[model samples]
Target: MTFRQKNKITVLGHDIKAGENCELSFGVANLHTSSSVDVPVIIERSKKPGPVVLFTAGIHGDEVNGVEIIRQIIAKGINKPKAGTIICIPIINVFGFINLNREFPDGRDLNRVFPGTKNGSLASRVAYKLVNEVIPDVDFIMDFHTGGAGRFNAPQIRIAKNNPKLDKLADVFGSPFVLYSKNIKKSFRNTCHKLDIPILLFEGGKSFHIDDQVTNTAVNGAKRVLNHLGMLSTRFKISKPKKMPVYILDSRWQRASFSGMFKPSIAINSKVTKGDVIGNITDPYGKFNHFVKASNSGYIINVNESPIVYQGDALFHITTKLK
Candidate 1:
């Protein structure tokens, strides 16, 4: 967890100097079949002195879109940076990514266990390493993520509510939706905010899958941010939204009133008024039917997309925001 010295940065026995780029192998805890889980860090340090920004993904392991976005950045685009360093961690939660799960082996969310202790659980240790070693050394950061399985998120940016500066960064990233989010306790974004390091959380697509449009949004967004920070040159084309972004105040899940075959009447971004029917839950044999209604007037941000549902299951996620 220690670095050799500044200028000649040593991370997990890999030495990186100015203008040097390489894949640094960070050894995580040893497994039965392998000596250690080698977390590859793609480090690129420019000759000119400037800021250091980190692009991180796969914190939940199942979120592959962010991982692919980071991979695309590191593969070729990052070399275009004019000054400063860019560190890309395509997959942070190695165990979760390997198992295609969200939580660590100890049944804890890695993102929710920031600034962890060395003697703590696996998730804690990983969080500790990131908080202590990675984030502190970076000037800015971009954390990419996606919706859970069966749910899709419109390309959006989530920032701490009331933070105007961060909101501007979200604008630079150019997502059509900007969520003024309440910081989750001990989350990666929360930790960064506490440290006063500028960070952006980009959410889009769905877990374990990739969309070409969403991927481009993410890549161009990163390019925009880097360009803003004076690390990368311009000529990067960012996608523009025809409709203005919706500023969300809050969101809540709409639970199914009946256990039955569910069919959604609303799609993502569909506008609805209060008491509007969003979907229908009916018996398999078409005996009983219950129409799901919206509680607050807003756009349908998420649809369960599951054909079958049980009573009390969240079938729709709606927010009280309209643009």
Candidate 2:
């Protein structure tokens, strides 16, 4: 195994040997004044050669749930994968993270630009660096994400369809909800697929505050994958969820019929039937009031936490079971 024997590796101008782990500051951007901001990526390699896996978070910056998930894994230091290399970038979009926003300083969505161009915008440059240099070398990827714009995801795994390998990987993570997404033109997932590297996306909670349920679920999911891959020992028997994951075939957002002070009747992940009152929209000063009902039956996957909404705004992201 390549990792089993001593080997030298250099990244960001830092040298790392097999069976070791270290943090390297990767240069991303520089301001006109003088200094540049470099992001930190932690690399861990095993003595035995195996698969190379990567975990990334903070693509949206305010989506700190994913960022925290990676941090906990690194802080615990329990996962010294016995076979392969694990590289983690707990915070990838330093600009978005520091600003508590979803996009780059230039207001471009980082996730929308992939296989980035160094000569392009800041988001483009960062994406280009990872796609050209970091992503091609990995065998597997587990990208973490969370809801944005006050939207909350019901702890789920979003994957690509028609790929058994991706399906199996998603199953291993074993979230309550498994969403199959068609490729978006410039998204990271699309770019990775083009490179033939399988990537699994785990999304839960909302941006900013860390939700305990979603955070813990994501951490365990990654460990489960390592155990399955023979990197982490499966001995001692890890507990499984009482129920299996629900596969979602289709989903839609329940938009507001009119603008008002929103009052939700249900919580995230709640089961509802067609015509169920998802919420009520009422005006504080006037007698105008309206109820939002489900168009079809299934689970309430994502909902906006913000009560103030306008007409035609998406108020609820509802999911339907696969036939």
Give the top-scoring candidate (lDDT): 2
Model 2: lowest-lDDT 10 consecutive positions: 1-10
Output the lDDT of residue 282, model 1: 88
* TM-score top scorer: 2
TM-scores across all candidates? 0.89, 0.92
The alpha-carbon deviation from the true structure for residue 258 of candidate 1, after best TM-score superposition, in angstroms, is 1.2
lDDT of each: 0.79, 0.82
lDDT of 2 by residue, 42-136 (tens): 88888877777889999999999999999988887635678777888888888888778899988999889887898999999999888876755
Which residue runs does candidate 2 get wrong by more than 4 Å?
1-15, 31-33, 233-237, 321-323
Report the CA-based lDDT of candidate 1 relative to the real structure: 0.79
As a TM-score, model 2 comes out at 0.92
Model 2 pairs whose backbones collide: 3-47, 3-48, 3-49, 4-47, 4-48, 116-128
* Cα error, candidate 2, residue 143 (Å): 0.6
Residue 45 local lDDT, model 1: 83
